[model samples]
Target: CNALNASCSDCLGNSKCMYCYTDNTCKLYPSGKIIPPSSYCALDKARWGTCLVNFEALLISMGVIGGVLLLTITGCCIYCCYCRKGKNKRYEREDAKFESQRMERKARQEERRNERRSRLDEIRMKYGLMKEDSAPYTRFDA
Candidate 1:
């Protein structure tokens, strides 16, 4: 209703006309004006000023941050997995090489021991300490 168009005769002396102005109005009161109050609404259309939060911008920022964190974590996991696989392969190769060398060293030591035993047997035979039919000396005999 237009406050200015109301007539005093229509009230039949029971009601009075009151003009609502912006100056004396409460800050929380709802106004029918299409434009918002400058105190509560920002000049920039993107913002809601001090009274409200910009949920669109807030949600978008959160999504972006979450995406970045997810990508970073994924990248780190992939890198760690790759590095661990490579390290395991390297360790296996080194272990196999070491095992082969150990086996070869054992074979060489056994050959040397056999050579020493043969030399001792030849010396015993020449000194007439053991006959051709006698059993060879053993570690337990010593």
Candidate 2:
């Protein structure tokens, strides 16, 4: 007896339909009120359900995006650490090589100094500059 679109012809001839408000999707109401019944309530309930699904999808998408960002940052850190380790090892090897070269040069210089000291002692002994019983050498006067 209500307007033709107000109710589905298949469900029932009774035009009184339920109203939907989120939690309360269906509550009985008489026909011909300002609010349309059966079909309208069902349509509103379907719309609300669709909105909820879309909101859930949005949250899931944000989580995936955040996870990607976290993984990218972690990967960059690992790469930097690996590169830095290589640089430090190279520097240490170079330092060790330089130190060994310096040590060899120092040993050669020490040998030359010892030879000079022995020559000076021999010259002093031949010239009788030092007494035989005296210590082999003393500091030069000048």
Candidate 3:
């Protein structure tokens, strides 16, 4: 109900939009001119400014920054993947080294068991408890 006339009547050919005042008057933007319905609103002509270029520059700068951030995130993701792969390879190498160490320990234990068996056989031969070239005796045999 507060809408005013928004028509321009001046040499600049600018039109005024009705504002929320319900006064039936047109006021020019950027100019403090109040034009009644009977007179032309020439005094309220808007002055053209260079704000469009500034807005365009701001938009382009934001786009460039956004693109740079996207590329940086992508690069970081790739680097992290490479680092994770390297860590996995390192872990596999360590696991293989541990397995080899376990196998060596088992081999050493088997060698020690063979040495004890040979010593026992020599003792059996000396005591005349074993036949020549026979298998080693268990505890039940003695």
Candidate 4:
């Protein structure tokens, strides 16, 4: 009886009521009427005991799931930002390369133009198409 922690004298005598270690009490509801010694236990169990384990498990699972979701979202955001930054840097490098190539092409074109002009001047000198002052001759007929 001491080990069982029975509340009612009948429970102690007849071994009918089961003791709950969580609340340290015995509970009994006979013929739809609650006994006084077990009333507190019954009320407490009704309010907090029925769904305690499931509630705690659900709360823990939700917290874990929320944390994982947050981590995933943050990781994806960081990855996307890094990818965009890398792409931007790549684009900048490509643009710089293209600009350098365009400048080289322009320099080559200028060199060709200069060479053609020099050749034309030389041909004019060899054919006597220019005067002594290096100006071309123009006809004036009255």
Candidate 5:
């Protein structure tokens, strides 16, 4: 990796390399490690993959991004649970209102039925169609 020493961009173009400004050298990245140790190259001066960002800025940006994503997921879960609880309460209220309306309609229908029955009985008595007690059966004129 040290052979590609023309510039930082040329040095980091290779996947397995890091560039350091302190010594103006490009070194092979240590295998099996995500980031180079600060001892090898100071975080602020180390450039990898892109010359536009330093190692320190990359670490900070990645950490901030990951933290924000975690918080957003947690907030969404809490909001969903809270809204579900309120929805259940609203459903219960709707059911109760429907039951009350049904009861009122039932009572009104029963009262109307009773009133019609009484009116019919009064008409029957006025026309003498309802027989009195101790009456005898007899043939009537057409």
Candidate 6:
């Protein structure tokens, strides 16, 4: 890909070649390294994949995109946690309300039972049907 007169499009035709805007020269892409070292070609001058953008711009764009994506994911996680905490608090409040209502109902039911028992006992005593606690044994006489 050392064609000095070849256009960037012509150099990019080969997958293993990169074009440099500094010298307008086509050179073989360095597959061993991640990015072409400054020795090979300046970052701003190096073009890979397409001739529309330089390597420096590509790196910056990719970095920005990755950072934004990371921040978005982090923000979503935080929001979810906050919502879940609020949900738990709501459930606790509802449970406490329900328990208080249950207690009130239970107390009313107990009061009604006590009142009914007392009325029955009073009627038994008035009719002389209730047994005396002092007298363990008693004979029935007509």
Answer with 5 or 6, whichever has the higher TM-score: 5
Decreasing lDDT order of the candidates: 6, 5, 4, 2, 3, 1
Residue lDDT tens for model 5, 74-108:
99999899988899999999999999999999999
User: How do the residues 101-136 of candidate 2 rate in per-residue lDDT, one tens digit apiece?
Assistant: 999999999999999989999999899886766577
Candidate 1 structure, TM-score to reference: 0.54
lDDT scores of the candidates, listed in order: 0.54, 0.58, 0.54, 0.59, 0.91, 0.91
Model 6, 37-111: lDDT tens per residue? 998899999998889999999999999999999999999999899988899999999999999999999999999
Candidate 5 matches the true fold with a TM-score of 0.78
14-91 in candidate 1: lDDT tens per residue? 222221232322132224643344554332321222213332454467789999999999999998999888999999
**Whole-model lDDT, model 1:** 0.54
Model 3, 1-142: lDDT tens digits are: 1132442222114333322123334444434543233233222322112212322344456689999999999999998899889999999999999999999999999999999999998998899987765567646755
After superposing candidate 6 on the true structure, give the runs of residues whose Cα lies further than 4 Å from its correct spot.
Answer: 3-5, 13-15, 120-142
Residue 99 lDDT in model 3? Answer: 100
Best by TM-score: 5
TM-score, prediction 4: 0.54
lDDT score of residue 31 within candidate 4:
33
How does residue 133 of candidate 4 score in lDDT? 68
Choose 4 or 5, whichever is better by lDDT.
5
TM for every model, in the order presented, reads 0.54, 0.47, 0.49, 0.54, 0.78, 0.70
- What lDDT score goes with residue 21 in model 5? 93
